[model samples]
Target: MLQIDRWKRILIIGLCVIGLAYAMPNLFYKRVEAHNDAVAAVEKAGGAATPEQEAAIALWPNWLPSSLVNLGLDLRGGAHLLAEVQVEQVYKARMDALWPELRRVLADQRSTIGAIRRVDAPDGQLRIEIENADQMSVAVQAARGLAVPVATLTGAGQDDLDVSAQGNTLTVQLSEAEKALTDDRTILQSLEIVRRRVDEVGTREPTIMRQGADRILIQVPGIGSAAELKALIGTTAQLTFNPVISTGSSADATPGIGEIILPSQEQPGLYYTLEATPVVTGEELTNAVPSTDQNGAPSVDFRFNPTGARKFGEYTSANVGQPFAIVLDNEVISAPVIRQAITTGSGQISGSMDYESANQLAVLLRAGALPAELTFLEERTIGPELGQDSIDAGRIAAAVGFVAVIFLMVASYGLFGVFASIALAVNMGLIFGILSAIGATLTLPGIAGIVLTIGMAVDANVLVFERIREELRTAKGPARAIDKGYQNAMSAIVDANITTLIIAAILFVLGSGPVKGFAVTLSIGIVTSVFTALWVTRLMTVTWFERRRPRTIEV
Candidate 1:
């Protein structure tokens, strides 16, 4: 009477086998990691592997699961940085872009508004002085016409630009609501760019997320140091091609309104004055790759999208025999003369860069530039040796807890306790297996969760065993007692586990970093423990009782 269906038994056994199979790779973490990395490299290289890669790939069987639970920064030892984004830069850039259009609108009504010139203001404000003081209203109206509704939900129907007039001067600045919306977008964009930059290097499990209003927290495992990580992402890499006004050797040279002076990268102290508005910016770039120029020197080739191509083509066609400055982060990389029109939408940037620099530049370009510059608020580098020590400590803690639980279960429940111990072992395997399958990262707190789970995994078994003792005292046969014991304990096991699981889910949803890691392990452990207790241990007990036909059992 106390029997599992054949299909259910097969399912349970199949799951355990699969769990073991997946968990096996973690035992040889380095070998399996090498194998996985090599495989990925070969795939990325279009099925070509070097001798070293081939050997690494052969370290593990091809048919088995090679995925391992990722180690978090605390366990893998890497770089940690808290950076505050210079979000005001975006506001300044936005105001700069709006200037040309605003000037054009006022220029169209020159007869009424009179001559207008841009006046210097704060970083994010645009101010213009008009010749006709009586026409200040007209200038303000023209500037306000350029205003667009904010795109954010909370700022719906609000104008992005706040325009006002004092005397003959008109001022335009971003509204408070729009500033808030821009801040959010800027931070989100910065986060994504940082993530892309990190992912380009193929590091494992980097924790990159927003920390607060204008900050991002970056934790990258396997990177050499915080400085290395910062260097990889710190460069704004803002590339632009602007029409050059003139070349000079003065570092403090003044430029006309709407123009900027940038130092040349190749020739120190040499500068180039260029138009503020770029012919084409890096945002329109579709692809970039490391390449070689006609002289066989390292360079980067880039292609632009349709809009960018049209703008670039028109600019080059009109500016033949003139030079355009290729600027990166406000520094002139090159000021090359345009001999002929370039309409192919593709161009090359060649400078005093080697292949390594060219390749890094290409990677950065492909990943896109950060929306705003970041100021590092804090930085730290963790060593691999420390991570190993933490791993060792966690292993000892889990093993000690596991052994104690086994000893208590076996001593208290006799043969039934052995079944529980076996189930507990299976439960641990299943947790790791699920973690590997899901590609979750394991942190120090996650290890503590696993240790806690080792103690809790036996609770359901204890309840069932106690209920069996009660049933046996009522004079029920072994089979009937075992069946009633499981049935009576099922509700309590489900209730307790479900409540704990709800808490785990809440923690996972609301918590960050280590808390989420703990919740992840605990949640996985709860499910596996429940399954092993109600089904796995019961199956073992029913099989033993059937084989032995025990007339009576002792608790």
Candidate 2:
């Protein structure tokens, strides 16, 4: 009567084999990691590997599962950075773009509004004074016409700009709702750009997320230091091509309103005045790669999207023989004269850069520019030695807990406890196997979760063993007692584990960072523990009883 079906026994054995197989790589972490890295390098190098790389690859078989549970920042040591994004910079850029449209709308009534002049205002505000005082209403109305509905959920039906007029001066600024939306968008974009930049460098399991209103938290494991991480992402790399107005050696030379002065990269102290509006910006770039120019000099070759190509073609065709400045982060890299129209949509950027610089520039361009500047507020570098110590501590704690649980289970339940202990081991293997398959990161808190699971894993076995003892006291044979014991304990086991699993899910949904890691491990442990207790231990017990055909059993 107490027996596992042929298919069910096969399924249980199959799962145990698969789980242990997947978990095998963690036993040889360094060798497996090196093999993985070498494989990646070989693929990156187009299936060509050096002698050392080939040796590393040969260390592990390609047919076996090589996935390992990624180590979290706390367990691997790395760079941590807290940066505040300068979101207001985007507001100034928005206002600058709005100026031309607002000016044109007001100019339609130039006869009434008279002379219009832009006045200096705060960074995020646009203020203009008109000569005709009585016609201020017309200017205000025209400026308000440029206001559009905010596109965010909370700011629905709200206008993006708040326009007000005092005397002959009309002032315009972003609405409060729009500002909030913009801040959210700015942080999201900044997060994405930072992720792309970090991913380009091939770091493992970097934690890049929004911290607050305008802050980002970045934790990259295996990086050298915080300064090195900062260096990789700090550059704004804002590239724009603007029509050059004039060239001058004086830094203080004023270039009228709507034009900017930037120093040349090659010629020290030499500056070029360029139009404020660019013909094409880096945002329109579709692709960029390092290449050699006509003179065999290092350069970055770039291709533009259709819209950018059209704008570039028209600008070059109309301004033939005119110089256009290639500006990067407000500094002019070069001001080359356009000898002919460039309708091909591709161009090269050449300056005082070598191949390394060109390659770095190409990477940055391909990743796109940061939406705004970032000011680092806090930075810390964690050493790998500390991470290794934490890892060792976790391992010891888990092993101690595991051994203590095994000892108690065996002493209390006798032979039944041995079955439970074996199931517990299988439960751990399943936990790690699932983690490796899903590529979850293991943190210190995750280790804590696993240790806690080791203690909890025996609960079902205890219940089943106690029930078997009760059945044996009622004079039931070993087979009936075993079957009834498992059946009677099923409800309690499911009830307890289900409630804990719900809590784990809630923790995962509401928490972040280490809390999330703990929740993930705990959740996986619960599922695997339940399976091993209900199916694995029961199968082993049934097989033993069937083979022995014992008339009575000691608990």
Candidate 3:
């Protein structure tokens, strides 16, 4: 241990230098953050950033280590929302979507099954009464043909649709396995939409994640309020293209089956009678952007995917001169007359929107529709003042803890204790350095974890030092004693730190929010502390001893 290998010494010094270099940016946190934001803005603006943003970017040099640890919501202050996704809404949509395909399939065999009429059923259930009652078995068989096998691990070979025949009617609904799949998809889609909307607002480090089976947890750091966040993500943005039957002042004008009346969003009191099934939905949209029409008015230009383009083109070519409604959330936003078939797969929507609303609609369309509406179950806004208070308190506690630990170590072990103290400081620098590199969020509980780390960093040093004292009684030279001490205490040091690390890993896996924050800091600190205590202090001690050639050392 006294005569260390050349590569091991280089590794120890290299790690220490890297740690301090990465930790240097945190000393000027605000300046570094401003620089990062400016760089991001410049990149987003196609390299044409404002003069002020350019000046901000110049505050920090590009060649240096620029990474900083991410601050958690409690540290930076922002909005938090707990939302439950209404998965049942997707069920109703699925049933509505299923009707069109079911109709087309059964209509192919109209001679055999006669006529098929939709009957009233529950929200997710589809019931069809066969005009020829004796041919109900044929209708059921045809509906069952629509059932496709699910591809999920647990849902393998499970039918997507459950079709049953009862008397003269056939019932069709999603199977239990299919509902589970739908719920999973709905929650995941909701999480992605919330993330996209929050990211579009340019907020820093937003945590948009799925909470439970059908819920989402959104925490945006450095945002204004929960209401602002809600405004960003609340819109369902369910845009649909429906075939219009007729337009009238009264909603009761169209009494055809599978037809309903909806009030126009643009023109109040005017209603449109549209088919229950839409020609195409927003799900088919590949891209949407805010652009100007030929008249230079703000409009949303959209492009459809191949499948949607084919469907829309077919509908348009067959129904030229007929009006179709661009419905948004069950309200007719626009009823335009189809002049020519748009085989190009791109179209523009001109409406009563200003630039801002048009831009918002473009963003919503680009982000795609939420699978289900999110009902806000809980909301809260964290103020920046409170975050500052937390910072101040944590600063004081960490400083006091560091100073107290340093004093106690120096008083007990003299020069050897001072070596341990230096290792302790290096341990902290490395922890923050790792956190910054990984972009881990530091919460209030994380600060506590740091303080806890400060206290525990000396455990290995204490064990080794005591062992040195025991070895000094048996060994002839102080150098021999020191080498024996490290080897003897190695098992105990590894056991204690590894056990703590196991607990930290468990917390990280099973915990959420603040608990996760604690786990992250604790886990980082353990690895750094062990490295600093063993290699760092040992390196410092052996170098001093070799340089001075101390025959009898106090340590």
Candidate 4:
């Protein structure tokens, strides 16, 4: 009996030593530079972060935010938004792509229909009119090539059309029927546009994802104010370059219909003539860098690729000294006079702006273009106070649970129960060490996992004690009873824990965000509990028995 108890004691002590050693890495991990920098920065910002806190930050999960593990919005207070991308513009683009085909189809049957005039519907549909109902029927056959199957078909026949209009007011019913609402091309194009627009306001780590149908969900933490985001996203960035016309010229002439004129070859006038055709478009520039001009003034230096450079060089050579306007999203950012031919494919854009404005303009130009305009449907922000309150409540609950479990074990198993309590404490230390090693954030639910582990830690001891009682009643000697108890209890311990572990795994796989956090902590706690209970507690009990052999075991 003493021999078997000695062996169990040795085994438990060895595991404890190894566990402590395995956890040693977390001690040094507390000193990583990123952890130090974050702590120092927080202190410099007038935040009261103690050394103990700085150490805790290092142990947080790598996947979680660097800040403290906060409760979800349900536990803590936060804002929520349901943002959706406007897909009407997608329909508009589709209509534009089909416009050319429509024009060709109408022109091909112009003679048969006897002159046809088409009006564009606001919802991006075409309404065709001819001489009479007979002519309309003929034109409809020609337009069939350009017409797509209407998902939401309405109205009766040609006289009572699906799309109706009176005088100039037109109404077309839009629906999501059997028709394909959006295609892969339109979705990709929309995503790119949203990305560009969101980046324009210099948002930090915005999570933009495509949702069901035609919706996008954007999540930005630590960003409370969303008015600026709304402004940047809602506005359509439509850019156009029009030539500067002479004041003396016809005021009745349209913007782009003016005569193509250039500045004089060798004269500097207050108002030099300009060309109706743009010399170069902004799309040609591959990159824009914020730099200082030769005069030390803030300027944006833009560079073009091989194809764009050749076209830019040709345009500059043809229009030397001509004033060209630099337009951005329809607003003229600058109008630099072509003083000299820029054949090098590189040019500087100098606007009457300060350094901040120049930098922003350069950033926008570099970010590329958006295919469609984005509309902000929702915005949310959470205060740090709410997160702190959650932490406090969770701490209280965990502390109470810890004390209750410790007292329960000690009362239930007497001396062996006391050792179980110690093992329980060590088990918790190992869990934190493991959590710290793996960089897992400890949320409120994670605290619950730890508390539950404290209670579960005594499960093996209960099984061992009940087996020992059964063995003694069956006429086994002290040593034999102890060995048989441990052997018999192992299966039950494994079975119960394995079932719980499986449940935790399922919760982790199926849950999201906070639920997943709870599952992770629960899973880790289960493994830690089994180790401390089956091995650590058993070893301590065996060691005590070897030293002080009791006569008839007292339950």
Instruction: Judging by lDDT against the true structure, name the best candidate.
Output: 1
lDDT, model 1, position 231: 92
Which residue pairs in candidate 3 collide?
Answer: none
**Which regions of candidate 2 fall more than 4 Å away from where they truly are?**
none
Prediction 1 TM-score vs. true: 0.99
lDDT (10s digit) by residue, model 2, range 398-440: 9999999999999998999999999999999999999998989
- Alpha-carbon deviation at 73 in model 4, angstroms: 7.6
Pairs that collide, model 1: none
Which candidate number would show the highest TM-score if scored against the true structure?
Answer: 1
Residue 282 in candidate 1 has what lDDT?
Answer: 95
lDDT winner between 2 and 3, please give it: 2
Winner on TM-score (1 vs 3): 1
Rank by lDDT, highest first.
1, 2, 3, 4
**Runs off by more than 4 Å, candidate 3:** 251-256
- Model 4, 1-555: lDDT tens per residue? 434455666776776665565455444443443464556567665987777766655654444323222234433443334455565665554554445565577677767656645554466454555544455555555555444454333421222123344443323333243114353345565566656756655443354557677666654443444554554444453332334544223333343222333322122232323443354555566778789988898988888777777877776677677656555554455566677767788877775667986776666566554545555576766565776687677768877877887788778767767877888778876776666556565656777777777677778778887887788888567777877888889999999999999998998887654566678778887888888877777666667777778765654
